[model samples]
Target: MISVPVSLVVVVPMCASLLIAVLGLTKYRCHWHISIVATFVSFIASLALLYNTLQIGRISYWLGGWEPPWGIEYVIDYYSGFVLVAITLVSLLTTVYAATYVKREVGESRDLSFAILNMLMVTGLHGIIVTGDLFNLYIFLEITSIAAYSLIGAGKKKGALVASFNYLILGTIGAIFVLIGVAYLYMITGTLNMADLRAILPVHYDSKVVFAAFAFITVGLAIKFALFPLHTWLLSAHSLAPAVVCSVLAASILKVTAYALIRVMFTVFEAGFTLEVIPATEILLVMSIIAIIVGGILTAAQTNLKRMLACSSLGQMGYIVLGVAIADQMAMTGSILHLLNHSLMKGGLFLIAGAIIHKVRIYDIADMKGVGRKMPLTMAAFTIIGLSMVGVPLTVGFVSKWHIAVGALKAGMWYIIPVIVASSLLTAFYFGRVIRNAYFASEGSDQGSSSKAHDHAHNQHGDRNSESRSEAPPGMVIPILIFAGLCIILGTAAFIPVSIAEKAAIMLLEGT
Candidate 1:
């Protein structure tokens, strides 16, 4: 197996990000081009790594030519390779879309710095996936978290700063928890390499230190991923960020956090310790089920379009956590499948929301009346993504639910089936309102105070909401369409993800 390019994926972006930051000082606006090329190069490297892993099995790269347990290591397996592909590819697409979107939203002066942050964000996320040491994981996790907080606050909205501050507080707390967990593990096992930890942890299977470490790591990851009850920071942070930034935050960071959660539980701790001995599966199951129902219920209560989509993410993420919590092979596969699925669908949804805001400055659901005709392509993309969100037939969302349901059945958790069905119905309730408002409503459909808001908008911005046939710029529309198309393609050719997920599931379950 090859390892040269594996290191390049992280190194290239890390170095380029520094260069981009330095370039940001000059008059030249070359940061965007450099950022896009760096991410695209990283994407190419991921493709090669995926190919190598698929052909020869998992590959490990040593840093400074040192062996594991003493030196840093980077491993590429089916799972990490799969996620790296998603992370890099989506980062590339967002970079392409962000050039114009950022120009229009955040203005031209901030574009260079934005591109630099974007590249660093991508670099940090890739580093999180490739690193194979517990301490290194925490380190990389911090890198991504800091970048996210800065990006979230980069918007012009007043609320953006508050939201970013909230995230900064909570995210730093989560990072500390992770650090403490890693230290506890190190104290007990005397090694930070994940493979070495897996080997050593079993001997201290009953140790309280090991158990405390697990608790710390899981809870920290839950908060970091914005899992329910801990999700207060996400609504404003994600909704207030610039469209491109929000899309990346919604799509990549938490998905990767979920991956890290799965890796720590199943890889570092071992399934025997996590599933059979400590019984974390059932605890996670109950929490996930709660998140599934409450997240959906809360999403339906939002008046703002972006807040609605942000809440829906809370519910959708529950599906992935549920799949992981179930501890059944099919459940694991379904969870992993949903991870990729949610990234595509939700990423597209947020991008569409951005497009809508850019074109019409409408943020409230009540303000979206008759928008379908005005921004047909943007709304069409939005509708396609929303349908997938509701798990409509022939969409990737449906496929995710089907597997999760079957996995629940396989695990004899018959009660969980109704949770899945009921969550879908609730999802339909909220998204259905958006569809009806967009397609079947009159110009006066805003009902009561929406007219007042519109008048205020008119006074402030001179008929920005006037009905028109314009759509988001082609740069923005193309990425939304690409993600929407993947919803159908991945759903129809379900074997591709199912195959990868099943392999990942088996290897994870059987590794020890």
Candidate 2:
């Protein structure tokens, strides 16, 4: 009987998205205004939900007046509410960013396509966070995945198509695995509602079907999350896709998969057969360590800015998984906080990358040398982001790492301290390279001595006035500054995030 306005929170933006799609790409003049306003409204609604949760209690809404044990429901607690805020903020910022960048990256026709894709992407994200049914989660997952595949393919680069194709193949496989798991779960439990299933699952712990369902959910969710080995499609897809696409996918969707994985592991299966019967924690721990080491090392090796950042994402995911793997209250708390922090840092970094790409039309790390001096504001923003990635103090990244370190200590996994230290160093090393190139490295003879076949487009750089005018447009620059400003503001307003993350973390640990 909870009368929360959950439906309006998710539906309004989604309806607008669909409307934009129907209006067609060309004629829709105010797509930016529409998208930005929709997300902003959603963000405000989420904040209201957060306030209501603190003042009241959990919020649940039944669809069509159907009760929870039988019909679909929308549930929001501390955790879901916090994530809703993060998703909305990032989606809003990225939409603002895409307004100008999309036109520059692709044509105006494709700009509309980007807008439509973004709207659906946010809808899918909102759907995942709000749904109370297991099958509904799968449905939302598909919606998000399909939109993501289309966006990745929206890139003009040939590599974008190949990346999207591979992601399509792998994403389909992951979704199938999840669907199969959901089916097995339903077959055994005879219910699709998550709350009902959670309550009923523990009673059937000894059944083979339930165990199979556990395996399916764990493995399937891992694949969708791009945990280690299943991450092949992620690097290239993130590297080649339009910058706006990368920012959204990296900042939110992948994290959502991890969020789902944790929700299933902790909330649904924490008391089920899986935790008691298997060494799931140890397995997650080992894989996480491998991912951390491998992702960091590989990040150091990439020459392209996008690919390097993409590989770095794998490392950050590993850290989150590591926290879950450690399975201590503090570690889990750190993991959850890191999830939000990583989204901000990575999203900001990618946005700046987009700015660089828009202004210079280049992707190589070498080409970025001393260009920071030219694009001081953009590079300054990039520097803050880069420092955050390295977990520098007074940045949001540091806050997460500090919690993670404490968590590692609490778990008595002192060995992980070294891994954390080493990975931090590796992060510094690779990010440092980018910093050096951006600020100090010489412009060099490479200006006109380029061998890239794509340099033909810039052959007209002889006209200095036109080249200077090529800086990123206002829509692009404004969002970048906004995100960069957020990095500083959030970093300074440390208690706000700490309190929210702590509340969400406590919810996950103790289970509402």
Candidate 3:
């Protein structure tokens, strides 16, 4: 296996963002090229790191030659290594898709800023996954949040600015809560290092300060990951933001926040403390159930495609949190697997939404009648990924859902089985509606629907005649197909990721 410093994964993108910012002053037109190259390097580095981690058990790199508990440390165990590869791979694909999507929707004038912020976002997400220090994780979390806010605000949509403002407010509150949690942990343990805190926190587990810290962090991260009721900022931010930005936000950013929560709950505090000490998992389980049902209903209620996908994301997040709350080895494995599965599923869906809008100038689900005939390839990919979201067999979605369901059974929580089934039904209903409109309905069926959608597309792209058949550029279509392919490939080859996730789950359950 190849060897590389874990820090290099974070550094490549960070430095690229700086380079892009500096070059933005010039007439450089290849910002996307730079972004793609940087993300590719980061992805390769992450893959190599994951390979080394699997070989050696754990890989830790100290910053500036300082050891852990004294200076920043980057660690890649099975869990983080798995997540690092998934996020970086998604980042690379999104960058490639954005090459054409951004140029058309956002214009070249703003490409530089978009490219720079995209790299910064990757840097922050990578930092969050690898950091061994609680404070450093918080720092990276804030970095990611800020970049996302800017990216959303940079969108050309009417409510983009307001969406960004709302996310900024909520995200800042979450960050403050996380900071306070870290401060409390440090005050009690005299160390910010996660491993060190894990060793010392057991003694202080009964401390009210520790309980308060866990509460603050859990609530804060719950908000960050958009776990239902707190997911108010996600719909607008996703609906109004640029396509590629939405892709990264839904796919990578949200998953990383969930990862941080997992790290804190299982790694820092241990399963016994999170699951048994205070009824945290019980409370979270209830919240997750509510999120699954409510998010699905909200998704089904949307007329707009982007809004529907955004709402669906809220429900998908529930699946992840549900596994975490289950706290068993199988459930934890499912939770971690869903992190990668949901990223691929949702990321591809958003990209397809962007592609449809880009080609047909339609955002309303009602306006999607006969779109399958126009962009056959794009819509085909969308259908496959949408089915995955519905947890169809032989897709990545079903594999994770199966594991979670069986995990629930293994844990003797049969009630959750019905919740999972109902959520899947809700998912099928909503996605089925779109697929029907796209494939079965007549091409001109949208003629009777509201012209507001047409007016919006007309004003933005100046393309009034959306009846003609068209497809998104190759640059965009290729990435979407790749994501769709992975949904099936990983599903059939389940052991590949399951092998790693199982190990990570065991490590967490054993409190290693």
Which predicted model would earn the best lDDT?
Answer: 3
lDDT of each residue in 1-512, candidate 1, tens digit only = 44555788888888988998877677665777888788889988998898898888888888888999899999888888888888887888888889779989988877777877888888888998888888888888888888888888888799999999999999999989988899999999899999999988899999999999999999999899988888999999988899888889888998988989999998898888889998788888988999999999999999899889888889888999999888888988889888889989888888888889999898888878768878888888778878888888888998888888999999999999999989999999898888766755556434523444554444324234545698888988998889988888988898888888788888888882
lDDT tens per residue, model 3, 223-259: 8999987999999998899888999999999999999
Best by TM-score: 3
Residue 145's lDDT in candidate 2: 92
Model with the higher TM-score, candidate 1 or 2: 1
Q: Candidate 1, after superposition: displacement of residue 318 in Å?
A: 0.9
Could you arrange the candidates by lDDT from highest to lowest? 3, 1, 2
- Better candidate by lDDT, 2 or 3: 3
TM-score of each: 0.95, 0.93, 0.95
The pairs that clash in candidate 1 are none
Model 2 global lDDT (CA atoms, 0 to 1): 0.81
Q: What is the per-residue lDDT of model 2 for residues 59-174, given as tens digits with 9 covering 90 to 100? A: 88898899987889988887777778788888888888887788777777677767877898898988888888888889889899999999999877899999999998998888
lDDT of each: 0.86, 0.81, 0.90
Off by over 4 Å in 1: 1-4, 448-467
lDDT of 2 at 10: 74
